[model samples]
Target: MSNQHQLRASVLASYGATALEIEELLAYNQNIFDRSFSTLPTKFPLPPEPHVAAWEEYATLAQEIGVFQALSSKLVQLQFPILEGISQTQVYRFATRKGVSADDMVEATGLILQQPEQLQLILHQSFVGVIPVLLASNREDFVSLVQALTMRNEPKPVPDSMGAYMVTGFNNWDRVRQYRQQWSAKNFGNCSESSWLEEFGRLILQKHLYQDRLIILSDGFYSNVSASDIGLSEVEWRRISLTIRLEHECTHYFTQRLFGSMRNNLLDELIADYRGIVAAIGHYRADWFLRFLGLESFPDYREGGRLQNYRGQPPLSENAFKILQALVKSAAENLERFDAQYGQELRTLNSQPIMLIALTYLTLEELACSEAHSYIQKILDQLRTSLKEAEEHLKSKP
Candidate 1:
């Protein structure tokens, strides 16, 4: 076995895997991919019409009432450009006017409650599926909106310098449904809430009916790194930064939707960052990814970079963390080599999804092993065969 395989086995052992069970981990991960393969959608879903309409109307109201103005004022007053400075408690107190029923303030704040848009509400068509995206041009507005939705209008510390947020299974009260309910009450005296009406309302409204998944993105340099930091012009960096950030979050959405897991783990980050870089630049650049993770100067981890975010559940020991770093560096470099060789073939095959699926089949350790390229190629080949068989079956039916 090569040194890379030795490192792989060492990392697995740290996670409580016995030396003999290394292959078991590989088999387990492969089983997950195999199970998910059959159910993966041939075509991703478009954004639901009703959901789009509801958000559009809500965004219009938020704009008309100057909610963005209030939010901007509050953010400035707090001297926090990002939402990380405020707590959810603070946001709730400010928006509710200290629990007083200031009707106008409450109404305006309520409308601004969840993901109030500063720029626009885009129905983004991602590789996995269409997801609603709340694009905020101003960083302050983005921070405030993220705080309102994720922290319940309360002030809370967001530790990392994150550029985008993905909200899943969000139980949001539908403003459109609220407006319709109010209109009905005003036109008719004391309209009783019937069971059928409740069910119908649930169907039409985003509220208790469905799991609302949205991506709240900021127009900021990725990971709060400035344009000059990477030697790119501001205009060019901003454009690429936005693409990378959106695709990064979408990659998480893809895994969560198809693989039943989205984790704050190094493996997940590596996979997402790979997809993001490819989407932005048409190929993966290992050095760019290393800089993003603060691993540009290998063996010397940057203190405040994203690598600190995935320290494991109970956290790894110091020596184990260093080993993990080595694994990440090796895996990233291996992926770059694989991409350089087979990128065009993968693209021509329209097998980006398959590529993602293949990644899920291997462990971070295996990805760092000497035969990583061959392992990925083997999985890709099998997936291609399965895909072709499915297509032929459909053609025969017609």
Candidate 2:
């Protein structure tokens, strides 16, 4: 075997791939023959105009909702879905008669951990730009709220493993109402909702509502792994897990706002998890990441491991699936090594933005290859130079 072949064989062996499986992977040969990595951009792209506008609008809404204030006095309440045979009004009255405050009602309905006042609207500063974040402390509440908001108040089943949800181009009904009134006056010289106006509103106005983007985050253990699993106390683990979740979702927000594409894919997950891990603990742990993806035992993937979530659109064949697992394992190990060597230098320069920008240039296949280190190092060097020059330019300004 050639040196490249020998290295490939070695990786497959380490992951406990059977000889037959190795041969099948070699035959598939997608990763083996094609090793193209994109050239890194000199600077990160600016956030798109629409994204910037959306952030501003969300900030205004947050202020209007008193998101920054303490939770004691706010009486914000969401119209939670009514249970079977019970009117929503009755539910509210029952809770009120029982002396349940609005906050307690929300909590008792499993829509949030505490009062609705505790729901914070954070304008998180990210490399792309400031993105709005709706931070929820409870996992159950996070799932339900996301379903309600994104699914038109429908009671959809949300997966327990999902800790964060991104809301993009979400219609603000308040804005929709204002737009409808204006449109009605312009078209018919009246603001009343006639039958024709209602039909038009249903078909057309709904599509044109002022759209916004935000992330709904849950403060759950990263990948639902408890503190005991990672050898940490409950409090410390919860804190770190929240940081990881926030950073992970922010990474997605970064890509969505800048690259204009976000998908349910392993490569995206890998990149997000890398940023999340580094942000939380200042280093990458391949084992922890693998565990998060249900690859801790390699050949035997855990039943509910996150890896099952991104099996591709049409899904991969069994042979292809095995090969994918091997690739992911190799890629993760390479990333961990890269972080260990360059993490301190990157952190010293506060280079997360540039780092994330550089990472977008490579693929999982390229990262899994034997030359992965060289490929990443080349991009990092270019990004570092750009970052330094930008800093120098800023310093010269004042």
* Total backbone collisions for each predicted model: 12, 0
Residue-by-residue lDDT tens digits, candidate 2, 1-398: 46556666666665566787666555433231121223223344344434445445555656676553322222122444423322345545554322234454543353333446556778777666567787877565676567656654445666666788888876443444445566777778554547545645474544434566778888788787879978999999999988888889888887776566667777788889999998899999999899888888988898777888887656666866877788988899998998899888777424776676667766665678778899888887876776677667767996
Give all candidates' CA lDDT scores: 0.67, 0.67
Off by over 4 Å in 1: 1-35, 44-53, 56-118, 175-191, 194-208
Which ranges in model 2 have alpha carbons more than 4 Å from their true place?
1-117, 176-209, 348-350, 384-398
Question: Candidates' TM-scores?
Answer: 0.75, 0.69
lDDT of 1: 0.67
RMSD of each: 6.6, 8.4
